[model samples]
Target: MRAMYTCSSLYMCGTRDSIRVAMSKLCTFLRHFGVVACIIQFCILLPFLCRTLPFSTYYGVTSGRINFQQRAKMLNEDRVKHANLYFKNMMASESYRHYHSIGNGTHMYLAVAVVTVRRSGVKRVNESMGYVLQTAAGIDSFARSRNFINRTFVFICNVDSQPHKHEEARFLEPYLPFTKRYGSSSFSVKDIQLPHSDLTYDEKMHKNTREKETFDYSYCLKVAESFHPEYVLMVEDDAVPHTDLSSVLEYSLDNHLVDKSKGTPVKKKFAFLKLYYPEKWQGFAFELPRVLELISIGCVGGGVSLLFGLMVRSSKTKLTHWTMCQYFVIGVIIFMLTAELVCRQNILELRRLSKYLYQFRQAPGCCTPAMLYPRAIVEPLTTYLTSLPSPQHTDLAIYDFVIQTQTPAYQLEPNLFHHIGMHSSLGTGDKDAEHFVSTFKIK
Candidate 1:
């Protein structure tokens, strides 16, 4: 029995030794190749990590798909909240009553013309109200808060030829000065005649719509001119003004429009100052300047990482493999590249830290939601627009005219207006309306 017990103990000890040997071998193998395996795994999972990680926690700027989803959800909630508030205020009739009672027909420093038509058969969170009421409420709220009612003139240019059909415009008439285009003596469909003699049925319909749109815009400009304000702001009825609209406009006028030395206006610097541009276009696109900037950043990051790796390798004699240093530098470069790609939206949010620090760039072509035009350009722009032989979209027509005339047009960064319209008044539904709403940054 004693001999059997000793043999069993020896067998157990041998088994333990064999297990230890196997573990040692495994550790040596990992020491030799673990870095490469780790790098491969990290590269494979980088995109997924970026999408899921909450970058806002570190950067104080919202980023990542998860963060964006949260932000979009919050925006929808805020929209619902604002809609309810605006509805209540409009219903009370006390908010805008004083502004309405103030007489129009006096010259003002600024004239804001809201060009709108009746939009029907559209779905909205607030069924009783559309974008116009919310927009009007926003404008009224801004004007009253800023005490701009006396110095600034606000009016609605209902371009819906049939005034009775536009009940919202009619409802707003008592609260703000409203003008209808149907019976205006100064505007006529004949005056905006375009060459559509050879066009097909569909083409003619489109052409007519485009011509009418241009006519409506031109008429609004003319109406604004009649007020004889130094600056005329044309706002689409569906474009809701941001809370910073008043301050930004004032800043723009003071800084960009006026000559500081003489304290006189130099309106020729720009044809018009755009208050809003599409949020999608504002991202870091692969333009030449942006590419150059990115490359420079990469070079700087690579240099710093290379230096860091060299310093560590020199200090630690154990890290003798040159490949270790190379891997370290490469890993850092990859990290920087990943951060740049993943945190693009967060990087953009950095620009919004200060509302007044926005830079002006050349105006980009597309929609015209909110534009502040100089009084000097009003008559000339109207004449140039009317002279176009072919019917074109108002925005395209204006862009063409700017290019042809060599007019220096500028657009503000961090848009001061939010485009809230789901339906286009130009006879088309916005297919990307949901995308716009989701991506729009309130800051």
Candidate 2:
């Protein structure tokens, strides 16, 4: 009888010990989780709190509580009249100055290879070319010299999917006058032709878009490589550089230094710099108070659960199955609260909060509106492009190449380039491109 009693006691002791260890782990997890959520809430609140408000009558009227959409609405009325004045007087003057300063240059320190495609015939202005011209002009203006732009050159490559009609090409020729290196000097189109596809319209568009973009990129690479520039800045025809871009570009490059201790100067010196994205890097939509409340609840519950476990502890007892289930329920509640607070963040926001721009472990975002490549890798980059899997979007192809080669790349905060192109060039016209029509009401 004593032997049987001893065996029963040992079994009870083992079960009690296991239950205690599980409770301890659960308590630690909840405490850590609550703390992490609090940190995330603070980071989300920082950007809006840090930026200063403009001392305007509009801000005063709204008490500075207005959102970006509301502020834009108020500013539009005030600035509408000056829009034309600024474009005609300020923009025209800047363009003239930029043109005179760099009137036909043979060599360049920085070469911006622009890939252009055909636009609707009715549209008079070439959107991408205009902004690029302005950026070069801004660089010149920043230095307070007209001829400073001679160090930079813009080469426009028109992809050759269809036969080049001189009459069709002339539609955008007006934008070319900003550079004296117009008319085949700076502007070029592919001479070869691509045969029509027997695939359905949607299918053909899906397949053809990548091929066209890849071809356009290769053309730009050839033109840029010929110049032997110290750095190649690749911009799709849809992208535009902000006027204050050069300073940031230079700062970002010099600020980030990835050691290539294993290779010579030609192997790699600097990482590829990303300059633009389609959206601001905001993570989640939870209100600051909402996150704070969730965190507080989690912390309080965790403490209560821990204390309850301690109080219920006895010499020879395991937690009841019902009690264990309650503990699990509490753990789940804590997880849901923390996950909702954290899951809204994008990779961009995470990087910014982490303060790690030069450090990259995954292949970066696959958008190539504006990117700078060091001269050291230009030859190897050319080889990579040529050997890449049969034509995909240049951005994705390049990203795949980066992963394959294990190359380090960099992305800057407050993207230096802006995607002003409203029209989607490669779409089937059913997607976001159709909304690019002007005069659409903004509610």
Local distance difference test scores for all models: 0.65, 0.49
Residue 345, candidate 2: Cα error in Å is 8.7
| Residue-by-residue lDDT tens digits, candidate 2, 242-358 | 544655555444444433455642333544777765442322347674356456556665656555555655544466667655654564465445444333222233343333342
- Candidate 1, residue 149: Cα displacement in angstroms equals 5.4
TM-score of each: 0.68, 0.50
What is the C-alpha local distance difference test score of candidate 1?
Answer: 0.65
Off by over 4 Å in 1: 1-81, 90-107, 120-129, 147-149, 183-207, 261-268, 296-340, 343-346, 439-443
Model 1: per-residue Cα lDDT over 370-401, one tens digit each: 99898988888887776688888898999888
| Cα shift from native, residue 414, model 2 (Å) | 2.4
State the lDDT at 243 in candidate 2.
42
Candidate 2 ranges beyond 4 A from true positions: 1-107, 120-149, 160-183, 186-207, 258-271, 280-363, 430-443
